[model samples]
Structures are given as C-alpha cells and as structure tokens.
Target chain A: MIPNTMKLFVGILRPEKFQLILASGIKYFAPPKNYDDIEIPERQRLRIYDKVPLYPSNLKPPKMQKRLRYMRGPELLHNKLQLKQYGVMATGGGRLRHEHFEMVRLQVARRLDMKRMFAIWRVDPPWQPVTKKGQGQRMGGGKGAIDHYVTPVKAGRIIFEVSGKCEYKEVYDMLRIIAERLPFKAIPVSQDIMEKMAADEKWQEENNLNKYTLKYIIQNNMGGCHRFISKYDHKWYGKYV
Target chain B: MSFIKKGLLQSPVPLMVAKRFRGKINVQKPRKPHFEKQLLIDISKPYYGPPKNSLPEITLCENINKKSYKREIDNPFERILAKECLDWFNTSKMVVFLHVNSISMEDKTPVFAALKKNDMHLRTYGKKIVSMATKGTRYEVINQLFTSHQNIIFGQPENAGKMFKILRKAPQLVVMGGIVEDRLISKNDLVEYSKLPSLDIVRSQLCSVLQSAGSCLVGQLNQNQQMLVSHLEKHIEIQNNPTNSDNLDTNAKSES
Candidate 1:
C-alpha cells in the first residue's frame, strides 16, 4: 500500500528516500511513566481565598499597633513543606495584601493543569487590618479608620504548595512569576531544593572559619554591644528586623 | 584694651553679627575618643582559618556517574540485603556492573531470563546497601558505579563470554565496568577478556610450550656429542680400510 503511494510521489521525490519512513515504525519507545501512586485530591485547583475576613456587624473593628515583629524573623513553624512538593517561599518579610492573594490565585488557576495537579495555600488569607487616614484628613485627629487588610508573611515562610502527578519543572514558572511579583524577596523551591538549602546552611554553620558569629557576639555582649542593638536583634542575632 | 574696644563697639550691629565678625577665633577642641568603640571595631574584623572541625566538602557532582537509589539502612531487611551483596561480591569470580537505562518490561524480562539461563544472577541493590557491603573491602572501588539505576551481574569467570553475548542483545544495559578474577577491568578490557580462551585451554597451551622448550634444549645439548661419535666412527672405518681411506681422504679434502 505504501509502495503505491510512493510510486505517485516518485515524480516529486525518490522512492528509496521513503524507505526511512517505513523504517521509522521500528522505533524503541520508552515505557510510559507510572502514576499509580499519585492519588489526586478531589479539588485539583487552588481554592478561592476571601478578600476580607467576615466580622460581626455589631462589634467595632479593633485597632492594632504596627506589630512589625509578626513580619520579622524567620518562619519557624511553616518553613518546611507539608505536602513535600513544590512551592513559593519568602526570603524576606512583608505583608501580603488581598490583591496579591488574588493575583497569585488567578495566575495559578490560569497556568495550572487542574486534571493532574493541585495547589494549596500555606499562608493564611488577609486577616491583619491596616489603618490609614483619608487623603485630606487633619493630622490632629485621634486615629485613622481601618483602610484594608493584609497577611503578614515572614522570611522562610512557604506561601503556597503545589503537588500531585506534576514535576517541579511544570509548576516552577507559575511559582516564579508569583515569587517575583511579591512585595518582599521570595523564591520558588521544590522539596529536594529546600532540603538541600537547609543542608547547605547547616554545612556552612559547621564549617564557618570565623570564630566570632553574630550569635556569639550578642550572647557574650562583646564591647557592650547589647546597649546599641535592639532586644529583637538579641533574639534573632540581627538576622531579621 | 580688648575690653574697652568691645564696650566701644557695642554700637548698631547685633550681638549675633558681632559674634560672627569676631576675628582670631580659637577653632581647636580636645578629643575624647571611645576606646570601647574601637575595641568593637577591632573585634568585628573577620579572622579566617581552617574550621576547628573541618569535614568533607558537600557536593553532588562527584556522584553523577552512578545513578543512585537511596534507601534507609536501619531496617533489618536492608541489613540482610547488604549481607547478601557482600556474599555476592566475595563468592562470584566475575561481577559486572551495568547502567540500566529505561527499558520496557518486555525487553527487560527476556534479557534477565537469558542471563539467568547462563548461570549469571543479576542483582539490584540500593546505594546504602552497596556502601555498607563494600566498605573496607577491595570491592569498594566499584561503589562509584552505584549512582543511579545499576544492575550487578554475578557469575563464574569462565562464563564471562556468555554473559557478554547475552548482554549484547540489550542495548539498554550498558556495561560500565566490572571485577573479573579479583581484578578491575574496563569495558574494553572486559570485551577482550570475554574473547580470551578458557582457563583450561590456556593451561594446556602453556604446558605444550614448556614441553617443546625442554625437547629443544635436549636436542641442542646432544648435538656436539653426536657429532664427535660420528667422527670416531669415521676414524675406525679409515683404519679398517687403508686403501679406502686414501679415496676417502681425497673426498674429505675436496669436501673440506
């Protein structure tokens, strides 16, 4: 059957050249990858996050201080990956506004292959209320009204996690776009990448040639440095504000 | 005189202007530096030396050649598997390490079955098991081949030729390197080794060469004595026939 088709094409191309076409059928195809263990969750897409927390109408909204400590220092609890997959982690501290949350959701939803992959939030939705004065309000006013809400994120905090049958390369671009757009420094990391980063940090600490570390100096109060540094600096060794 | 001039010049100009216009003002002030601050700066300077507890460099590139399958060795099963690997390493005269690329189940089954038929057993041990078994042993050099997916084929040295023949059919299993007769051999050396004659045949050939050398030496040692005996026989013959000796003399002179 192919020879008859080849005869027609002979005027345009040689029949011997078509021999490779027939030979192409004998290719050794690699075995299909096994995804038997991948149990995709019912919700294969990122869940929608609330723009604002539902507060009781009768109660007056509570005002709070700057409480910058919430966004300072490294995240100790949520620093590790729970799902053991790919995610975006903050390298510095900042607030995640409701707009940033929506932006991340939209980007992930648009790029995610929902059939094989699912994304889950690691950080909570916007809950911390940020107050601001009106544009032309007088400075003598007692206090400003609650303007908007934000989620305080700290260094080493994993923003969100993506897991399922997909690989790190598949979700890296989506995570990277989110990381780059965040108000603070952030990076995309997979499980192994995160593990390696931790290992490298441990290795550096173990192999540090300098005998005097920041922790060592603060602990010993060398040169009465405690008088110059803040209490937070004493706690975090000036690693964070 | 300076006080009189100050009182006289207390005229129209303001006190600020008078102070600004003052001439020959003293500019120098006493310096009281903070020695503690200087001490802090001195201590802040980084002094680097070798770490007190220096360890091996952390690296991933060094183990890239071998595809490793890492497994925890704390389990009792892993210990048994490690022991088995040690036994395989010690008992087998030929141990061939192969890098297994992705091969379909159909292809892999046949290749494994063929190897099994030739009395060659193929084993796949995790990197942890291999390290545990090969540590402090001569087979430790082969630990480099445990990087990724590796198959170790164990058999007698004489069956190396058959193993190579069966392995040739499956291109997915690349022959990396192996130990043949307690000696490490590369891929090319393995091929050469497989082509070599069997041990019995080589032993017979060596015996034949030795026997031939002995016979040649015996022949060489008897050559001068045999020539001398032939000359004595010729002299006896010459005495027995003097008339014949004269004719023989003329022939011997011509021959000489």
Candidate 2:
C-alpha cells in the first residue's frame, strides 16, 4: 500500500480544472486547437491609415540679428567633449529636411537596439516652414502657402551623436553611410580623434606655432611696428602711435 | 477512572502555578499645546496653458519682416573648411595639395575618386598616427606631418608616387606640401621614394631571410651527424662478419 504523501491521483474530476492544471503537462494525445491557432491573412495583418490633415506652418518669427554667421569659432567643442562617443559632424552647411531626419532616425534605430545603443540629434528638427508661390501667379499679391520645412545646419555642427556599448570600428561604417547620404558633406569622428585634435590645437597655441594670431600676422606683415610705438601711448590709439 | 483521565494523570505534573497579578496606575502628565504661523506662496501658472498671449513676444527686425530679404554677407561657411584643413595639416604626415586651379572638371573627376579611395586607407592608418602624435614630450604633430600619411592615400608614399606619375602625365597640376620638411626633394627623388618597397614588404623580406639562414644552419649541423651514422654502420658490418673483416684487412694492406 502506498503512503498518503506518496499517493498520486490519475483521474480528472472537472474538465475545466483538468485543462487549467494539465496546461503545462506533457501531452500523450493530440492537443485541441485554441484561438491562437487561427492564421491571420497577410493582407489583413498590416493596416494602412488614410492621409493626415495638414496644419498651418508655424514659422519662427524674425528677430533682431545677433551674429551674422550661423555658427562661428569652436562653440560645439564642449558638446563634443560631453558626448565623447562615435558621432557624425557636418563638414559643409546646408538645410536638412524633416524627411531626412526621420529616415536617419529610422535607419539608426533599426540597426542599433534603442535600449543598449541610441543616437542624440545634435541639430534641431525642421521647425521653420518655407512656402512657395504657385506657378504663373502674379508677383504683387499675398505670400505663397507653406511648401515644406527645413533645419538650417551650419558647418562644424554635429548633426547626430551615437553612443553606448559600441566600438568606433563597428559604428564607423554606419556613420559613414549616414554621412554620405546627408545633403551636406559630413565625416565620422570618434572621441579619441576629437580629443587628439583639441590637444594638437592646444599644443600649437602654446608653442606659438599657431599662425592665426593677430600678433603673428602683424609681426610677419608689418615688420615689427611695436618697436616704433611709445609705451606711454594711449592703448586705443592705432598702431601708428 | 476512564482511560483518558488515567492518561492525563499519568503525564508529568505542572512545575508551578501563577498567582493573581497586581500593579499601581499612575496619573499621566498634561500635554503642552504649541502654535506656529503658516505662510503660503502663490505659485504662478505656466505660460503655455490657455491664453497664449501671456507668452513673451520676440521683437522682429523691420528689414527681416519684409517678404524677401538677402542674408548678411559673411564667409561663415568657409570656417569649417578652414578648420578641417587645419586638422589635416595637424594630423597628416604629408599633405600634397594639388593645384586644381587649372585642371578642368573632366580631368578632376579621376583625381577626386582617387582621393576618396585614399581617404579610406588613411582612416585605417589614422590610429597609429593619432597615437604617435598624442604620446611623449616632443611635438608629435610635426613628426606625424613629416612621417605619417595616417594611412590616407593622398599623402602616402605610394600615393605620392602615383601622383608623381599623374603629374608626369598631366604637367598642369602643381603639387605643394602644406607641411614639408626644410630639406626639399626633387620630383625624381619623390618618385624614387614612392617606388621603394613599403614597410610591410621590407619587414616580410627580412623575416624570410632570417628563416632561410636558420634552415641553412640546421642543415649544416645535421650533415656531420649523417656522416658519423654512415661510418658507424660500416664499422658494425666489419665487426659482425669475421671473413669480411679478414678480407677488409687484406684489402687495406694491399691498398697501403
């Protein structure tokens, strides 16, 4: 006789309870088809939405001119240092469209898993809409309706920053592909490369090898005019003093 | 007595019994009441919610507000190119700036393609140059400018040779070095340098030569052992046969 603790029951009392209990059990008999067994047709699997209504273009209001140039000097140096991973920097300036941004974002997201790997949009998306006049329309009437929008990218501006668990070699090809497809010329740059460039620039400046200085230009071009100028002369007075 | 009563009685007796417990109740102390003033601050609602007019207005320039206006005349676009050029100068071992000023668009296409191809090569070599430039006390940038092309084809020794050949074919494109050594080389000298075997090829050749020399020494060492083995076999054969040994001794005496 089997002990009570060791005894096992083989019969099923309730059919519903049998399924609930034996759901995970190994099946000796063929299993019945459930709702999940039904096949979905390929055509009906994906649904497409109708055209979306267009909204009025929200253009950035014209404001007082601060600086004439879009981006000058090394303003993005700190930004580069902060996100010191493999990224793409625009070598030439141009307008980037909304579709371009979406395509790039989709391509990157598809290739790299968003959880472990991601990209930061260095440039803002196209917010200012540009309008075009209809063909053969009179020149003097009202302004044309908004056609499309674009984000004006300046040279030396970083368009995108891709970071996370990825090596430069692994990311370089993707970045190069993105760079080639971009409207403006762009180049793949890594943290080490940028750091090296910055260090080289600093070294050049320290050793006075940097020929861009005003003093160097003056010395080379004006033949040391500082010798003729009096030490007591007013600072504002031209080099003639 | 019943069996249950007998079992209970048979069990061990209780060790002790508890007596009635007693305690004194003390009066609680009176609680002290305290009053404090409360201050409220009216937090301003966010400007984005209803009534968009609450948002600050940005002043527009009269000229800019006009339908069509020209941008300011400034060369901001050139700055990036200048910076890139500076980087090339700083990083490259050699920079051969081809004077495409006179070269036609048709002629320039091939050159651009070649440059594009060379850029990939440069990237491969970029790491070595970067490391070399970043390390130690001396000016690595200057050293790199003189020695490394960063694997890029444009300033690479081989590319320089190819460029020399191209220059020979098309005399119009003048090559100028952005960062050249003080001691200048003629066109022929540059062509010669380019014709010379690359570092990899030279290293491989040296390895092969060493391998051959090692193999030759091993062969020489083995030759003496082979001669001794043959002599030992002859001596063993002479000792194994008395008649052959006697014939061998007669033959030796006759030969002497």
Highest TM-score: give the candidate number.
1
The parts of candidate 2 lying over 4 Å away from their true place are A1-68, A71-78, A113-115, A206-241, B1-256
For candidate 1, write residues A1-241 as lDDT tens digits. Answer: 5687787777558655654311111223445566668788988766777877888999877877766768878899999988888999999888999889888889988999988888899988888888899998889777788888889988899999998887888899999999999888899999999999989888877766767777788799886787766566578775565
- Model 2 lDDT tens row, B78-193: 33433444465455565453333345657755655565666512222233334433345333443433222222233544456565555565555555433333234544465566
DockQ of 1: 0.07
Clashes of each: 6, 5
Candidate 2 structure quality by residue, lDDT tens digits, A184-224:
66788998987887798677556553333433333343334
**What are the per-residue Cα lDDT tens digits for candidate 1 across B1-256?**
8998788866766655433322221112212325653455455545455554574565425776778977622556656778999999999999999887777779988888998998899887767679888999988888887764468999998888898889888999899888988999898999999998988999999999999999999999999999999999998987899988789789999999
Cα RMSD to native, each candidate? 19.3, 42.0
- Each candidate: what lDDT? 0.81, 0.53
Classify candidate 1 by CAPRI docking class: incorrect
For candidate 1, the per-residue lDDT at A207 reads 65
iRMS for model 2? 34.7
